[model samples]
Target: MRLLPAALSAAVLGAVLATGACGAASADPRVDAPVPAAQVAPAAQAAPAAPAAAQEVLPQRQAAAPPRPVSSGGASRAPVSDPGMDAAADGLRPFLLTPAEIGPEFTAGEEPRPDPATPAPCGGPGVVAQFPFAVRVGAAAESANGLVQETVSVYGDEAGAAEAYRASVAGMSCSEGRVDGRPAVIAPAEDLRADLGHDEATGWRIGGAGFDVVMISVREGEVVMNFTVLAAEDGLPALPDPLTVAKAGTQKLLG
Candidate 1:
């Protein structure tokens, strides 16, 4: 598993404060804005999307190209039945650390509902899910530290995953919009690297007012994974670095 790590340093944190990027919107920024016709799943309990168009407008690199098969050695390559996608979630749980590992104040939240049409914090739209099955773990933010969420999707073949990865990389460029009803500015995560190993990966920082959200998207083999963290700008306890979380996730998924 080739994984690029996104490390947060003091200089990066200082820059974020100076920019005042994606702060919460006041009374909602653009109520008249056309919601993506696809209708995003309400983020009520899910991780909110980054500020950018809900639909991906960038030209994806050869989306139809098939992903190269991962070197599986001599093992047989037989796909197994995954009813209701529970097996997929079970496979990913080991990659993410528990609340106890993060801190005593943290508590686990319910599994996130599948959001088919929401824009990803680092990636654009729901391109990650090329096949019908996907699973998500919602944000767990009972603690004052911050909120964290992750989603994983299995593509039927490598091409879908490759396409999704291409879209995510394209989103690294900056864009402004109202995400989940709040004003936001999304741009490349220059402070933290997005390419955490493997074929394709990218990161983004969506900042606003006194709050900030960081996201990383990675594609390994036939899997597309996303990790996001949101925290208050100042005060309270220090939040977990989203890059570390994403690295760990890709390691587990690809190793």
Candidate 2:
């Protein structure tokens, strides 16, 4: 082989020596040193994840109350049964007539064949009687000859009064009608008995004009009172007004 240049030969020799030195450092315990705690890299630490966002909850809603019922006329109505009647009777006794004051001889009869053209005591075309009876505090009398008429009798007791009133009306030609604002049986009659409620009697001989009649008999306290009314053959044009007047008069006389 030809001789190499001095520079190349020297470079090759230095590379070989460096390689040998590196291999020796790796293999030899004396040349290698242990790694220090500070020099060694520590394991990477993971940061805590951010807290999850809080959920929002809504409150539950409550139910509403029901509505009340209304009437057809928009008015509140009263119950059919009432306890006020008995109470009123009890409180109003002091103002009523007693039975003793009303004499037993009171009678209801037709005027005998009065002149047809002449006006009657009641200021009507026919002569009809206004029978009188005693009440708790006042006296009252009623005539016959109206659209509806009434006759009354007062018995010693309530049962007697009711019976007499029913019987007297039953014999007459008229139908039932309310009396003293209460449902009652009315009839047509010329005379009525003086008992509990017999204002309208049978075989009444009156001038041809017909009349409607009402009868009432009330037993308040120790008194038995009778009330009757005679209305024109025509129904009372003022209905309750006439009845009211009759009732007021009775109360005044009896109480």
Whole-model Cα lDDT per candidate?
0.41, 0.23
**Each prediction's TM-score against the native?**
0.58, 0.24
Per-residue alpha-carbon lDDT of candidate 2 for residues 97-186, written as tens digits (9 for 90 to 100) = 332232232232221111223222112221111111111111222222121112112223545434433433332333222111111222
Backbone clashes in candidate 1 total 13
Error of 2 at 24 (Å): 99
For model 1, how does the per-residue alpha-carbon lDDT over 1-255 read when each residue is reduced to its tens digit? Answer: 222233333345445435655544333211110000001121211122221221121111223111110100000011133444454455445554566655576666433344334343333443322223333332233244455555555555667556645654553454553344344455544433434676656666554333455656666666666665555433112556666676765564455
Q: Which ten residues in a row have the lowest lDDT in candidate 2?
A: 28-37
Model 2: residues with Cα > 4 Å off, grouped in runs: 1-226, 238-240
Highest lDDT among the candidates is held by which one?
Answer: 1
